[model samples]
Target: MSAKSRKKNKYNFLMRMRPVLRWVLRLRSTPKAIAGGLGLGTFIAFTPTMGIQLILAVLGATFFNLNRPAAVIPVWITNPITVAPIYTFNYWLGRHIWEGPPLTEVSRQFLEIGRTMARLSFWDIKDQIIAVLSMGRDVLIPLVIGSLAIGLITGILVYLFSYRLLCIFLFRRGKKRLLNNN
Candidate 1:
């Protein structure tokens, strides 16, 4: 593409993003509201359920009258690229909290078990499923607890940082307006 065309495309992209950005900036939320939104977004982002983050964020933002875009944007942090790391961290955190084996050891064992299972017959697969289902509580309990803890921590941190940044941006704009008026 020509330089001019590239520039135009860039401008167009920015223009399209402007409405969403402005919506976030114009939110009349108190600091608490902003923080709540950020925290909620972070919590939703780390949910084990996939493919529903955006919907959850929209509902949360609307219910709370928060900046919808601001609340939704941070959820992208838990997308495909970061999923493994986030889950691994959660697993390790769970292990620590539960006084269980380290995540790395569990992961190694899991891999070994998976490899063995791959060579199993269809009947064996069915048996495995039944076994897992029978003891589902053992697996699920730790997962739920760890995910909630991590989500809460992540939410608090995001809220604090975003609130501070938003405050700075608003303050700078107010200062500029005063200077212009003077």
Candidate 2:
């Protein structure tokens, strides 16, 4: 994309998130709390806990006394639009780490299993296990390890970047207030 188009896209994305973010950025929390919460959320986003990431992030933020929204919002990183790519990459990274079937083979098997699963009833627990096993050994092991590796690395980077940016913003705001008072 062109630079202008990219910037517009970025702006649009932010505007979409404004509702969820309107208060968090305005909160008078410390950089550590905001950044730490963001980091925690980032790590959790990459985990296999798709359905419970937000809850986990919120609980973690509460336990750690971090900024709640900062922790919770990042969990949206694993939303429907992003889930396929994230999980696929996780599986790809995992296979490289743990040694397994190639990406194409595993992805094909996974699709077949997914199709079977769609027709399956919730009561068919045994059938589910068998279907999962048909692809899990190749997908599960690598996914777990790769998810952890990516989560940790990405979380730390997010924390550091957010901390620095927050610090700068707070410093400038404080200085502006001081100048106005003087």
Candidate 3:
């Protein structure tokens, strides 16, 4: 359990997994399909919704004729570790798109409201709820629009980049094989 041994073990595990990863990547599919799959997968990954990655990827792949596996792989980008930052970015982008004012003061107001909620009587709580409800729409509307825009732009970029990269790799490899056979 020493730190050095733990590091070595982790490295060994990854090394062992390399072959499986390579085989998955080597599945017979056109480069364009693979690229589209990767792009779509990455795009879907940004959504905060859970348990939908594979379903989205499959549907997207079928509709777009992308490589299912490629499209699915990048969907893990928004997993537990990255979710917070992703959501924060999405919220900020949404606010910007909605032309909303900064939320710093509003967030402080929310924190204060939460702190006071326990001290408030029933009537006070009702008033607080009314206040929040009135303000919530303004804050949320921009967030939704911004997140959708970011997801779409990111997806398209991922698709184009993946497609181009895969194409170049395949083309170069094919040329090398051809030249070697001569």
Question: Each candidate's lDDT (Cα)?
Answer: 0.67, 0.79, 0.68
| lDDT per residue (tens digit) for residues 73-171 in model 1 | 778776444655665666677766565555675555444434444555534545434432332454445555677898888888988887887788788
Clashes of 3: 1
Estimate the TM-score of every prediction. 0.62, 0.74, 0.64
Candidate of highest TM-score = 2
Candidate 1 residues lying further than 4 Å off, grouped into runs, are 1-32, 99-136
Per-residue error (Å), model 3, residue 135? 14
State which candidate, 1 or 3, has the greater lDDT: 3
Judged by whole-model lDDT over C-alpha atoms, candidate 2 comes out at: 0.79
Spell out the clash pairs found in candidate 2: none
lDDT winner between 1 and 2, please give it.
Answer: 2
Between 2 and 3, whose lDDT is larger?
2
Candidate order (TM-score)? 2, 3, 1
Residue pairs with colliding backbones in model 3 are 37-71
